[model samples]
Target chain A: MRIQSLCAALAILALAGCAADPAPTEQFRLTEQALEQAKAVGATDDVPELKLAEQKFTRAQGSMADQSFKNARMRAEQAELDARLAEARVLTQKSQEQLTALDARIIRLRKQLGEVQ
Target chain B: MSVFKKLGGGLLVLGCAGLFGCASQGSESALQQANSSFQSVKDDSNVLRNAPRDVIRAGESLARADRLSNYWGSGADVRHYAYLSQRYSEIAREHSNEAMNQERLAKLELERQRLQLALREAKLLSVQQQGKWLEEQIVSLATTETDRGLVMTLGDVLFDTGEADLKSSANRTVLKLVQFLQLNPKRVVRIEGYTDSTGARQDNLQLSRARAQAVADVLIDLGIDEKRIQVEGYGDEYPVEANASERGRAKNRRVEIVFSDEKGRLGAAR
Candidate 1:
């Protein structure tokens, strides 16, 4: 009877291992949107985070094709965050460039004011 | 035989547990790293203020990872949630940085505007201080008030020989003209160029026009409206003196600025 119970417990463990997670269609959509938004904000492939996001998103697509719902969801979720980080980084860089340009203009104005005075 | 089978089953369970324990070690460090990242961002008031939602998501993911770390054979799930939590924290930090930069940009833009205004006012004030004396000098230089209008003569010395570029010596006169135009916004001027009778007629005409354009360009650069100024080249045609002597030719090679009345009505072109 103990041997039978052990076999039954092993079978339950195997069943649990094979449990199918629901397809992460919503996650795939969210990942795609994040990538598109990053691109819209001028996040190019040169950005490391954007490149990572693209690579992971492609792998997530592969997982989806293989019906590995858990893998697909994890990869997609990470890719979404990576794309968002890329977008934020690009915007911050652009703002920094603007600040530099404005600073140069202010310096020039100050010099001109000095000359005027 | 039944004892042997039970021992084998027990060994199988031990082997599975050993495998999970090994995987859990790797995930344990990942959970720790993610928890630290989340803790840093969660405590940053700027991050909390700028990216409350992302911070909350990071905390939630870290909690989920922490819960999964306690479960046997859930290493993959624990690591996945840890990775997610770490990414959320990083994203939160970036968002806060961007927000702070935007705030600084706004403040810098305002400062730039204020400085620009101060510079403009300082320039106008300096010009006003020199305006009266410069006006007298200009009136004396442009003494010929013929039927054409009030005409000021810029002698050839203001430019290099055969070149249209005005020298630095012309800056004061140019600034005075700019100030005069700014003060009398309704007044317009026609800049006419004349050359000596020494060069070829075609070349002289082109040179005269280029010289006139150079002066007009300086006026435009100094903030005078292009519409208020007309340019013309009268190459050796209407000389103020004969081209018979060096003195006469020197007098003839000049640029004449014709000013309109205060009503913005320009005199008819020559």
Candidate 2:
């Protein structure tokens, strides 16, 4: 009976371990999708946060492959947030560039009108 | 068998305790604060409208944080997601603020351009009005625009026959001409005198020259710059009509004052 209880306990612990550390596939996929979205917004070229997010996402994939689910999840969450930040930064930069171009156009028009030298 | 049972019970107890430990989530207040901050930002109309993508990203992060806390009891990771959610929401709000500022600047620039155009139009209109006033003054002088500029005829009635001095009655017309000339100092004047065909050529030439010089002297006395006046005598040449008629001879014995171009340069007689 004692041998039977030990075997049962070992089986339960093994099952719990398997359930608890499921590969973090969903988190990895979500982070990759977020990175793609950032790239779509030109974040990859214009925003440093995007590159950092990519690095973190790659590290998260490595952790997931190593069966470090908790670390992988944490890094994936971080990567997702970084990608969002990058998207926001790229949008702000684009708006600022448009405003700058408009200002230059206004100055040129003002000069043409002889309002400015 | 008894040792095995005891080992299994101990392991079960330890596992239960560990499960309880994981269940006891920390950073609950942190997650709550982040949610509250995000809610406030999302409530802003500008952020909701202008930064929709950023707002959606923030919502997703907040949802992830909620899931991590409720399903896994991961305190530190939940707090991180919450923080990111709050940060992203704030970024959206910041983007809204910048967009609004840029829009306002664009509107102000457009208004500035409009006002400048209006001012330029007003200036041009004022110059045109001044030109109209000058045209009216020229009409009162009986002057006509010509290739040379404005030409005003001083009939021979202003001087006695065979005389070089101007009649005192001509003062009023001379004064008006003087005012017009003073108003347009950049314009020069040329005075030309002619005679009828009755006089000898030499005497007529000398008399015409004298009459032209006398008229020029009057203009100088009236404050016109002496350097801007030129005097000439045509001596019965370039008649206005046939000198055989008395009325035509009266017209021929007259002085004509020609105004110069805008640069004060007078054209030669045609």
Candidate 3:
């Protein structure tokens, strides 16, 4: 009975060890890179997605400090996506502004053409 | 003791089911939302064409989320993947929009170039149609081929008294000048302004400069390159006539356009 109880205890310990996640160092690096790329593309805190990314990234860092590898990985992964979305949003807005300016120029050109005719 | 143990095991199983039930409910909704987002982006041909990789990633993430939702105690992972999938779909849509806009911008740019060319040609033709008569008038008015090169004088009558504004009567002459410069693209011009000795010297200087600038502004508006024109204010100096008589002062109050040679060799400014 003593041997059986010891075996059960060892099995539970192995299971617990298996449940614990590995430190997500690579994921953290990827998150940081994504955040930097978003900022480079003119994503400011005014952008909601960028704000979310910053908040989550900070929380992910806190989780890392606490050794909650699962939480840290999840938050960092989400943060990366948020930052990417922010960057994409900023690019889309810039392209839209360009379109508006182009449209205005075309309209002005047409008006000039009309006057000339 | 055995019956009590059986009751305890049953209660434990019930409690575990309750926890998983709540978790699965939330995870199920999140998965559904992500699936919807992915489906929309996947259906969009433009999104597929422009952001195929992102759309594929979104679908893959959504599938992972769906698979995770079937397991107990994996609710957080399911939600995280679902969120990622949704974000990817949104990013894909935005990228496709940007691509479409860029394509439209290119087409519009081409159209704009074509329209610009048409406008320029129309202007040149209109100017040429009125060219013959205006050319004669300009030759008669441009009386002097002085040492300062071909000098054409625009008299004080072209401006309102004490005002720097050119009268509408000067429009034909200005348009003709614009046409002449366009025809001789290489030729440059220096517009010099003079005022009568009636005003204060300082005032005369400012007025002369302003008048010259006014003519230059019109030339620029009519499409002459600003670099091709130089403006100067002679004030009461270098008078074509004496300041003693009103007719002489009127003659002195003038703007003279000095043209460069065919090779754009402009004479030195006086």
Candidate 4:
């Protein structure tokens, strides 16, 4: 009876093994990475009005870190919006950077042609 | 040493052959299960061909559900038979269900057509002979009973914001409702009040009950027998719309007519 019970216990463990899922750390990491990518653009026009949304998001996050899930969820939503804004800002900055690089390259080519002439 | 080695080699060959035979037999059984289930699905579809359109559609849905249910496998050869059978059974079951739905839909269509025809005839008879909106109002949302009575809805438009004060606009609505009730005096009147989820749950319930009693009070004033009226409050629990949006909340805050002798039984759609 003891041996049979051991075999049954092993079988149950095998079946239950499939349910032992890890925490969704990967999703959080992806969200964080996306957020950082969005911030690298630094294209905020820096008007006083632009600071309002950022302030709200900061407050929400502070409340969330205090172990308040309700406030955390609300802050996370705002954070997503902020991240989107950051993404747009970064995209504009990158585009401007690219244009500046192209202008420099064109100036260099023109100087080379003048020398050749 | 040579004789011992020969005997061992022969035994190993026999064991390998036996293992191979078992594998082949397992595969054959799996194939049989898969094929039988496939045939079942085919037969189910054949039934669908003659089924009405609704039945056919439901059967199609069932078939897809079956595929989803059974297609997930243990991902092993030994489990191949079970997986195949599951997949095939799902397919077959869905097809059969759809076929049945098609037939049922056809019958519903017939019933609807018959009802419509009857409605037209009733309307014509009342207009040509009696000259009125036929007292026999056929509405879909109300509950049906052996008795035909007038059904009316008086909304929060009659009340103040968050308060159950009977407003002035409520007069016209109440008057109209009163006339309907007077016309069908023997019928029962069920007054139900509902609220949006803006307030505390306890407050909402009290408000609903208050509003319901208010309506009942008005009907009683209009000469409807107090004993004939059944007043109840469902509150925000049975909202007709989602409480998230403003417009939805606006719709949620109201009193609705549930049972009309003419329309049958109507309530917040569950």
Where is model 4 chain A poorest over a 10-residue stretch in terms of lDDT? A43-52
In order, candidate lDDTs are 0.89, 0.79, 0.89, 0.54
* Candidate 1 Cα errors over 4 Å, as ranges: A1-18, B1-11, B139-183, B187-270
The DockQ-based CAPRI class assigned to model 3 is acceptable
Decreasing DockQ order of the candidates: 1, 3, 2, 4
lDDT (tens digit, per residue) of candidate 3 on B1-270: 667556755655675577587667777888899999999999999999999999999999999998888776577778899999999999999889989988998998998899889999998887666564555667787647889888899999999988999999999899989988887788899999999899799999999999999999999999999999999998888987889999999999999999898789999998
The number of the candidate with the highest TM-score is 1
- Backbone clashes in each candidate structure, one number apiece? 0, 0, 0, 22
- Which is better, 2 or 4, measured by lDDT? 2
Cα displacement (angstroms), candidate 1, residue B251, comes to: 20
- For lDDT, candidate 3 versus 4, the one ahead is 3
lDDT at A36, model 4? 58
DockQ of 1: 0.51
The residue-by-residue lDDT of candidate 4 on B1-270, one tens digit each, is 667556755655575566456555544455456555555554655534532342333334334434433322222333333332433344335334444555555565565556556556665554444312223332222323333333444555668888887887777667756665565555566777889999799999899888989888888988988876777788798776898998888878887554444333433332
lDDT of 3 at B155: 91
lDDT of 3 by residue, A1-117 (tens): 455446456656855874598999999999999999999999999999999999999999999999988889999999999999999999999989988998998899899889988
| Model 2 C-alpha lDDT per residue in residues B12-109, reported as the tens digit of each score | 77765665465455557767877887888788888898888778878888888888777433666677888778778867886786677678767867
Q: Over the true interface residues, superposed, what is the Cα RMSD of model 3?
A: 3.3
* Model 3 spans with C-alpha error above 4 angstroms: A1-19, B1-15, B138-270
Candidate 4: Cα lDDT at B144: 34
Candidate 4 is graded, for docking, as incorrect
